[model samples]
Target: MATSNQGYIASELARNDFQNTYDLLVRACASHPERMAFSCGDSHLSFAELARQADALARYLRHGLGLQPGDRLALQLPNSLQYPIATFAALQAGLVLVNTNPQYTAAEARHQFRDSGARAILVLDRLLPLVRAVQADTAIEHILLTSVDDMENPRYDGDEPGTQRFMQALRIGAELPPVEPVAGLERLALLQYTGGTTGVSKGAMLSHYNLLANIIQTLELFGKPGLLEPATDVRIAPLPLYHIMAFATNCLGSVGMGLHTVLIRDGRNLDEIIEAMLRHPFTLLTGINTLFVGLMNHPRFGEVDFSHLKWVTAGGAALNDEVARRWKQLTGAPIREGFGLTETSPVVTTSTSISPHRDGYIGLPLIETELRTVDDDGHDVAPEQPGELWVRGPQVMQGYWQRPEDSAQALTADGWLKTGDIAVLDAEGFVKIVDRKKDMILVSGFNVYPNEIEDTVMCHPGVRECVAIGVPDARKGEAVKLYVSLKDTALDAEALIAHCRQFLTGYKVPSFVEVLDDLPKSSVGKLLRRELRDRARAEVG
Candidate 1:
């Protein structure tokens, strides 16, 4: 018998645990077809309905649209009943999923769709204007449209060239001949585009094996009983379903575990999230640092029932200590913070409970995962010292899609993927994410991490949110400049600086402060430091 210490081998697990990504659905349908699988607003889809719909859509994608095996399909819809249906259908039909950001502008959308050479796209009807704006620039040959109102009919009834309603397509597909599942789990399943914050976004090539490894790894770490309570546990999916965190845990993991998932179309809407929690009393909540801060800060935060919450996992950004402590104090549920990137199938280290509490705590590496930190000399760093974190795991992505040179730069010959984030591993095997190596600032020969400054700044009561970035300085080479959004009290720049001085050293204190109504954020709500850096460069220019 294979012991748990050996961890999971994706190839063997594919043969034993489950067959493929779509197989998760197949098992769920067979076990409990009448149970609610997915819920959006007032509408719910049972496992049986989901199976019928996904198969129909899969047939339509294969035969009707002529999307052959290995073709790329861009999913531009938000968190709705349509997303899960499209996801499984595309996979079953042997198409690679290009998870597009629904909030993207025409230029961004065009860049992704054209770069991936996507042959078809499923977009929202309200975003038909965007499709009209960029359809000429891409390889998109067919359009499957859906609306928020009708699960069947799109709002854009106009016969735009190549446009068809998604539900109607599914209905038509049901009458077509059934298609066979693709062979091998090694085939590419998703082209997850990342690095948009740092530079030109490139698609990380994730095979079915990579996603399946993560799905099982997460279950292994936080499985059974109190954490993943099988059929009774309801997941409040406020994060966009397209994002790796929600996609792996909320969509795939939930379906695999027979858990009901409530999808929130707009996670930024605090009222909507609260209302969903009140209605369903969710046991799972997958969110980031900013969202936790926002929800706890909301006036009606106290109204939502926390009795049913068993898991509140944070990722996509570093978790602030203040926010974490406050969340636990209020909800009685510790936010199990994890860390990963799209390249690693979006999970590497996760914390269930930090026995020894520490800031930047991201627990241990997942099963069958190896982690290392190296200095600038490319040698392993001493324990408790900060260095670039590298990961080698079963879940690591195969490579970047169609960018061989870029892929080589990211993945070493031995299969180690350079994470580019600074981290420290304690003697106890605990991990702490110090900050991004690229985001570090140099102040008069001293290293200053923006996360440290921002974390300290966030301790103030009046500071709602803040982002710290380095700016050009004649004296210090690079000076720390802070941008903040206020919540309560009339604290000015000098007052906030004084507050910081009490906790931080002179060099770490902000040289300038700009109070803004809102700071730019990515679709996943991570603070966009690259955008801030660009703004600073433009200001100096």
Candidate 2:
């Protein structure tokens, strides 16, 4: 694949009829059978083991559970060996895998299960009670349960009518005939649910081609200069595999390159993450801004050896400049910020090792991707002018699952997926996000980007973290409110408000300031401005 001068992906990698997830897994096994494919703690699996277990599970899904092609199966496990095993198994069975967040409550799980029409769920045993509560409300008929220690030691304590042990299913399936690979690219492989901060969560339909295109595009960009040296590159896979960024990068990209990925179940646990880092000389690291900040702040982070670290990619949220700078200073590797949504196989633009990255700019669009900024009227915006970013690429999703109206609203008639993010395109084609359009504070018709306020406030030496949201006001129509968690408890709101005055206009300056312990964030560590907005509404009322 070759990139054009304008940053559009003009071509793609040549594949010898490798079309779907099943095909990719098959190729990985055949290419590097002895290579370590996935590892979590002491439990690990090679490419051959991954394929064998996946094929066994695939047979069980097809024959034992009587699940046919196109059936939905919810996967609610954390970042473990089972994640990739079940993922490949479900895809090979020709089943659409619904990647479920392990942190979801019963109601959220029910909504996803019901919406996706998932007939079965392969979940961790600890979360079985939550699934059992919602099982009657959804179409789910079978519950395949596995424990955290199942990978090391397979065990089944009980046998329920609809619920079975995950390891038992694999064992039973292994006794059956080997499953055959079905070739097709258009078929749906995953129904990855978008983080529903605005409204109810909707599943983004990702086809085999969509996922493959993204993996190849990312590899073409980051896989160069020893990014994916087989058996040599060890990736720190801390992000949940359920998310597209981790799934596509680790499950697909790393595995396809025949690399080893050490899966960390809980990345927020600083001690555990530090221990993982000390265990392996990881070549690559993938995570969000919050993870980076947490790692850099951890006292033991500097103690760990980072000699083997090569590339670090940050996504899922905006990377704080301070965090990126500190990371580079500590590790000597610049934090490459990428931009994408769940709809675009979760990767649209990123900084490569070969390219340079500006402070707040998301680097060039991936190969075969076309990104443009449009005004409210849908007309193209000029360079360096903030507008809604729209993207057209093979990696774009098919649409929202069973939500044609929502999909129609998000996608343009000409095939561009409206990213809903306000970004400015530089002369060099780098994109800098202003903020979410809905989160833009309108104070007396003046646009006040929360990102600007938050960034400024976060720059305060006393402030540990901060979030900005617009509140209803009778006089100004709306007013900016800053919520901050202080690094020093002695710092007061008046002092922080004065700090904001230095960098913001009168309208953009926060009218109200509140110091809290911490701000709300999504599972993936993205700041939740909507939660702050709701809190502001209630406080005002």
Candidate 3:
């Protein structure tokens, strides 16, 4: 799997000692048995204790739930201690883990469960209503629900009985029947879903080899002198686990290197997150640009300690110049912006601790990653010219799960993954994302597909045609703006907006809705999204 493009070789990354991500966990248990691996508020779990819990949960899934290898298990827990425990347990039991957002509506839940062919779900109790509504129609059979306090300290007596029941299941310790071992390197480890801009969200099939190679590559990238020592490194895990970037950089990356992780249960609770940071001085912190801005703007941010912080890496969205500068000025630490997608094991290029931090650039690709700027015809473009970024390496995902058409469109005939993002590559091999090819709106690091919103809006009888576009916002990276042509003369913007609330998420609902006599369209009747985007810019100005 070697390709020579741009004088760089793209080959399958050399495999590491760990068979799979779970194997890394097992090794961590052996090496740092007594060391604390994770902390969520007052509750802490050592590496050995974590491994034992995972084994118990794996046994429950196998003997009690009757789950088999390759079965999909949907997880909708927040960033609590239970998340990583359930995730590793599912992987250890040879089940494909499907990460789900806890805030999803019933419709969204149904779509994902059906699309992933998930047989069982381990969700928080608050989200049970959404699951119960869609459970009958989907393939989900087993339901294991937990409360918010399930993994929290027992002293906080909120829901003790429910937590006790859940713990009892894990402590039952049934003797699991022996089954044939599946090679961890070749097995599908996780099915991470990305919101498809043109169609339904498809699961990105990431194999164990892909994930393990990425962890090794990332470790090598950050292997600077005296910066990150595994025994002393402490990281903040505030980013959502459903996001591939957080899952890789914060969870697996820390565990692989025997680093301590401080889990933030709610990212929105800036006061609590800052308090935790002050209490436990972390060496490395990973989050999106918006999170950095939020922390800097918080009233109590100045009271927190930033002495132990060595690096702050930003991903999921582009870091704005003002936000980066403000963070550096406040904390005296530069915010390193990086580029990645769910397809590239969530990290393609990242700024290292050794590099002088800048605002816009996403730094250079990893040691074995090959990045090229290709034109529409699949021919390579010169450096400095903005074109679609094509990547080929061990970090790239195998393909979209059960989506041959999408997989074909995403990957080239020569095996290059055609990232729909427009970027320019410098002579030094640094890449900067200019624009997105798909009409996907990045609202606070979450992908809000225009098609999903348009479909929901079109359900209204008054709306004939609609186009959703992303408009720049001061706080959020982008806000959704919609232009619509009406079928009925009596329909007003307020009525249509009210109609949209019935089916769309709050973020997906158009912040600015305008009714038009006709929408701009090409001669062939295709909606001209570029024209609408230009109109949005003019309106914003």
| Pairs that collide, model 1 | none
lDDT, residue 471, candidate 3: 93
* lDDT (C-alpha) at residue 282 in model 2: 85
Sorting all predicted structures by lDDT, with the top scorer first, yields: 2, 1, 3
Please provide, for model 2 over 1-541, each residue's C-alpha lDDT reduced to its tens digit, 9 standing for 90 to 100. 1136333222443434565667777778777899888889789899999999999999999999999889999999988899999988988888999998787666668889999999999999888888988989999988899988898888856566668998889889999877776568889999998643343668999998888888777767766674557768888888888878888887888776778999998766778888999988888888877677678778998788888787788776666677777888998887888988889997899986557677779888887788888899999898999999999888999999998988998888888998888999987788898867666665543446677677778888999888888887754557889898888899998898888776554666898998889889999998787888888989889
Q: Estimate each model's TM-score.
A: 0.80, 0.81, 0.93
- Model-by-model lDDT, in order? 0.81, 0.82, 0.80
Error of 1 at 128 (Å): 1.7
The TM-score that candidate 3 achieves is: 0.93
The ten-residue window of minimal lDDT in model 1 covers 1-10
Model 3: per-residue Cα lDDT over 203-234, one tens digit each: 99998878887887777668767778878778
Deviation from native of the Cα of residue 417 in model 3, angstroms: 0.4
All-Cα superposition RMSD per candidate:
10.5, 10.3, 3.3
For candidate 3, which ten residues in a row score worst on lDDT? Answer: 1-10
What is candidate 2's CA lDDT for residue 78? Answer: 83
